[model samples]
Target chain A: MSDSTQVAATPAAPAEVPVAVRRAAAKPVSFGQVVGRSPFVPYLFLLPGLALFVVFFAWPAVEAVEASFTDYSIVNPLHVVGFANYTELFHDEVFLAALGHSLIVMVGLLPFSVAIPLWLAILVNRKLRGIQVFRAVYFLPVITSMITVAVAWNYVFADKGVLNWLVATLGLSDAPIHFLLDPHWALASVILVEGWKGIGTYMMIYLAGLQAIPGDLYEAAEIDGAGAWQRFTRVTLPLMRPFMAVALAIEMVNALQVFTSVYVLTQGGPNDHTTTAGYFVWSQAFQHYRFGYASAAGVVVWAILIALALVNHRLTNGKQANTP
Target chain B: MSERQVLRRRRGARWTVRRIGVYLLLAAIAVVFVWPFLFLLATAFKAPTQDVYSFPPSLIPRPPVLTWLHNAWTQIPFPRYLLNSLLYVLGGVPLFVLISAMTAYPLATASFRGSKVMFFAILSTMFVPAELMLIPRFLVANQLGLTNTYAGVILPGVLSAFGVFLLRQAFAAVPAELGEAARLDGCGEWRVFWTVMLPVVRPTLAISAIFGFIFIWNDFLWPLVVLNDDTKYPIALGIAYLTGISGTDTRTLSAGTLLSLVPIVVFFLLLQRQILEGAKGAVKG
Candidate 1:
């Protein structure tokens, strides 16, 4: 089955075609000839998907924007509040703290999403036996649900858990740290779990990038009497910039929208220290029934994410030009 | 021995030592990655008399029991959640793949008017983060009276840019000659798409299905928002609900969480090769 599919999927083998036929085939076929000459055929095929996209995405997106400008809620009738929701968001201490916490999470996640994963990818990008096993093991967390991960981590963050035991054994602190309960440590603990769960995905991305790098470049570097560290610094790091950009882009989006872990682990707890932008949106809308306020907050996050994505694109493309 | 031979022997010994060190380092990291699941496993089966939390975490549940597993099964609607998750994957993945293929086929093969515009419009959905969509999507669903329905949970998620993008690449890779040959046989475009094109791109379809299965199975937030009924919860949400009610019953919670993980982990393990390769292909594309 696969062989037949491969044959069909591949372009017409050059050897099988006569010179005349090949020459004739060189002329591009018109789209009309391919599907009965009716322009509506393609539209028919696209109808279901497009319909869903409009109903689910386009409609909702417009509603989100429109709802943001008004004081909308399930209980109260909709009223146009102009920029009140946005203005209130700026002044609201909780929302500002939530945004600040999201920023910290994004920065804290850099090592997990970029540096640590790159190192792990390099370590595992070897020809040794059973290396695939290591890759699969690392990727385990990526496949599991965040809820399950949070539940598993609860045991680790418990008062008499493995983490506390390790810290005490290492003489880091006298008393056990209340990782989820303490306001000071709650956000950091949430970040740790989020980062830990994400390391696998970023590691795989780096591994893909690493595998794409030509081996002969390293061989050439070795021939030039460059040591391993120098080879990595000079050849590997530069080639890896594109992959790093991809990782950072994904990490930023993920960090900004970190609700599941916060929900499962801390619930913005111990005085809302762990509340993030994503959590704030959920809490305002669902928990407190402030749909308009939440929509406004969501729009701000959406704007920031788009801006970050644009800046990342500019930086990566700009650096690519400068390097070569 | 000659001096050169002695030098070679010394170098071989150093290489062996380095190999051992690398292996040891890898094993340690592997443990760090796998330890949590192992702990969950141990805790789920832990005897009632054994302390779940200890200073030096004892992982080996001495004379492990099935009491917590029983509790996890009977205390909540575990079977109902499992069945709902199964139904979701069954209802969602096929439709997801089919819609992606249908959408991608025209975009990939035909050069119709507004094709590029349509493609970008679909691709632009990738930027609209799910978190940001929650409130208004809920409002839309509420307006449509889809809230608390199975369709509400499954419909919004079936269409994704990633699936369309991946399937577009797959459809584009197929030789045009095959379609031409089928057309010569008086096959309509629909027949060509269903029989000729789809079978040829079966592997890509499989890849899409695997990803869809994992996604729909583990979808938490959308279902949580859409469905207020506990009986309709998927396994992931079910586990969260379990955690909420079980509170400090760590053993039962661990058991429930472990059970929730079984289907996904097993699916992943079985298709790890395809999934890992597909992950790379996804990024490169």
Candidate 2:
């Protein structure tokens, strides 16, 4: 056949060609040749995700920093104000209180996220019948929407709800405590709700770690005459340190991002006791229409998170543990 | 019986008692974890005349009625909001999974330059707190004219570093021989990836899909910030709005909350195994 006829008669290549064509021909027609050769085939695969990361994450993150310095409203033209927003954030009492409350919630949630979940993990780790059922039940809250969780907790926190009834029946107090309405109790109640919802996640993480421990270790410990508590303390606790580090990191991230519960339960209210840093940022941006100022506060919060993460890293000796 | 036999019997009795004690502990903790939901279910069905909060805090609904559910259905655009949430989940999850897979494929198999850089870049995004990103992300969407649009919510959510990382691990764990076999058969890299590799990592995809579904369905703040119009509000936001209405009663709120939770809770029940395995693999992987 003539060369022109051969070129015309050859079948069109499929779109899903490989980078290195193995076609059995003297002159191979590779995808690289057909599509114009470049070393970016891998990047071509990465383009969609990278585009999203740039537009949604990198671009916005840059804008967050820029907005923190400028006086940009949604409607108004932007003006570079040179750290005025940051200065204002320092002076803003609500911002300070919000920062304080965020820290408080983080500290408060450690018990729920680390300690109680570890306890629950140990309890459920036993080879009991229907253990999976209990696990599934415990995990229900973690999967449910936060709005539902907040609403459910609302009933339990109501003045005449089960909690108050229990307290009264126990003679702890004669009068009902308005859990969500009283400033003294609102933050604690919100923290409790957040912690309750989060227990399952941490528990599952610990359970996985517990499951990884060989049965022989426990048996060996038993043979050594180590008591139950002693086995847990000496065997399980030492083995669980890495898992705890991972859980602690995850918990810190979740606790600092505590907005949905506050929004649904208290609206960060009863005199701003539950207004976490996350809520403060939202209120500034959406409610007060201070987008620039909110961006500044976001930067501050982000810095704090980074610092805390670094500290956690130092504490954990920068171990290359998997993050849950 | 001998003294040794008596000692063995007493020890056996103590062991049984300890097992019973363990069962009791599990039962009590289960009550603590599950009671709120039970209370919610009870309140949703209780009649308006029924005291939801009595001195004893009863869970049994006396003369359960569906009136509150009906009221909640009418009070807001519940069905529309449900559709919106379904739209978010349906639109967001597959794209999220696809993008995650595409990103992970090259990172897993490609020996090209800058692959590690790309991996670390994605990892860094994990540390960028979600709350901090809200304002700037909203602004970026506005600049792109995606504000108040479903694309706005779905597109940003498509890039989940956790999904990408998990899928990367999954994809890497598949033997290299599989890809080489497909390649020798004149199957292109894309074909090898799509047909041969994707199936191997199907479990990871399912795991990410379930998580993506949960996240998108329950994502309140991002959708709240992006979509100004209440008509486009997801179910979570709709429930929040319902909670805001002064006239919305407890029974109605309870009903609305229950309705909002059903789809994902049911999903969890159906796919609990995959999710729990996914959680475990996340640590181990």
Candidate 3:
């Protein structure tokens, strides 16, 4: 900041400027002057974290993109496949199936993860007694490990397990029907588990969004003789639009990338009906040793996610943008 | 009664009925939801010869016993697997917490060159499916001779993008003035963070730690892929081992799986409040 003045103020300035400016130039620059009066120690505090990001995230990404172009298949191992893998992936039936499953999962998870949870948050948002206890109880599965949750559910859904036991006594079916391992029931089983575990988390998020809205809006709605439905549609839903967009985006991304649940529950089995893009990618790359094809699949998943994100941004922001 | 009073009274009664209806709906749903867990628990306590199905879905076993738990213990190295899981979680969670916090602080506050781009790069990494990185990660691990070691499982998590993103949101809230004062007081950069900013984001740290514990403890795929030794098997892997075999008995498999989840469930019950509070505060914050 002071560099120009110091250069101009030199007493023996060689006709570059007048003596008055030259004198201003002679003052020395101190470390404090350069870095400001604040501590340089925070940067020191951040050094380790910065190094870790480099090792884990940055390094891994660089390697992954590079690996994509090659014949990085695990079975045959990595080679330079160029665009062959990408071209081949377009026609690959299993890859397409997995991609379709991922989309279905993302599209389906919204109501369970976001909508129902939002409803739950609103229900408990009342000034009722013991509601806080319900909040904790509902959120129990959210904190539990997915592996344990999935495994536990597997037993519960066994051919002769509790669910079947319940169904049999009711005479709902002739015999025990499969849940987790069944071709027909596997994906549905996954969805139920996903919803149970996720609803509580997004409920909290919706609560935050709800709390941010002014209480007076609802009070004013009441003053205007609006009923509960009217208040919700006019005041609550409109105000919550932005949060809905965010919550949807968050849950969509999470559901699309689901692995542990699918992995532990079915491993994309029952004729690969439940196989998601993530499992497909894992199998193609690691199990089958086809890294190039797997990388192509990864690129496809990335494309879908980015497209959905952009579309969501546009839909959410379009009205606001039009208003301005 | 006045008309308004009569209306409110009638409405209140109607509201009570509707609420009861809602409550019943929720209760029935909760029953369907929680039954699987109940089934597993009963299946765990049932004897081998006993039919695993619960008539009327008995949450309680008529003869609650430790026979299945005992069989599972003897059949597998149950204690050893539990120890391995505990060991991995112990090392993994703290390591992830510390590393993520460290990375998050600077990225949140720094004015270094390429800072915005750096932050975006990290955020974009979250968009990529984790499975996409598995082969490359395994390759790197194989090259480093880290496969089957704690290093393989631990390193990928230690510098988690999500953890960094989560913590940075908190750390960024530390006022610049407070940091300046600490610096002027000769605390150094380390002390300013440790003494001033660190305390402010303890909730975030706690939140991240809870998630880190869950993720590290429950990790199935990476552990399945990397850790090759039976001796190194974590509980999740052990549980998978029980039910994953083809044509397995519904009884023994269910029994073994339920026993495996007992520890994590117990942990969840103990920490449920803290974890929920932490998670709610975090995304909301």
State which candidate has the highest TM-score: 1
**Model 2: residues >4 Å from true position, as ranges?**
A1-39, A74-77, A314-324, B1-17, B184-186, B246-248
lDDT of 1 by residue, A1-324 (tens): 112332333322222223354346444553344443465878888999999999899999899889899999989998999999999999999999999999999999999998899999999999988888888898888888889888888778988988999999999999999999998889989999999999988988888888988889999999999998999999999988888887998899889999999988988997989999999998998789898898899889988988897898888888667442
Candidate 3 stretches with Cα past 4 Å from truth are A1-46, A74-78, A127-129, A159-185, A310-324, B1-29, B245-247
Interface RMSD of 1: 5.9
lDDT of 3 by residue, B103-138 (tens): 677677656555677677666766877887776677
Fnat per predicted structure, each in turn: 0.54, 0.56, 0.40
Q: Chain A TM-score of each model, in the order shown? A: 0.88, 0.85, 0.80
RMSD each, Å: 4.2, 6.1, 7.9
In model 2, pairs of residues that clash are: none
Instruction: Report clashes for each candidate as comma-separated counts.
Output: 0, 0, 22
Model 2 Cα displacement at B248 (Å)?
A: 4.8
Docking class of 3: acceptable
Interface RMSD of 2: 6.8
User: How does residue B98 of candidate 2 score in lDDT?
Assistant: 95
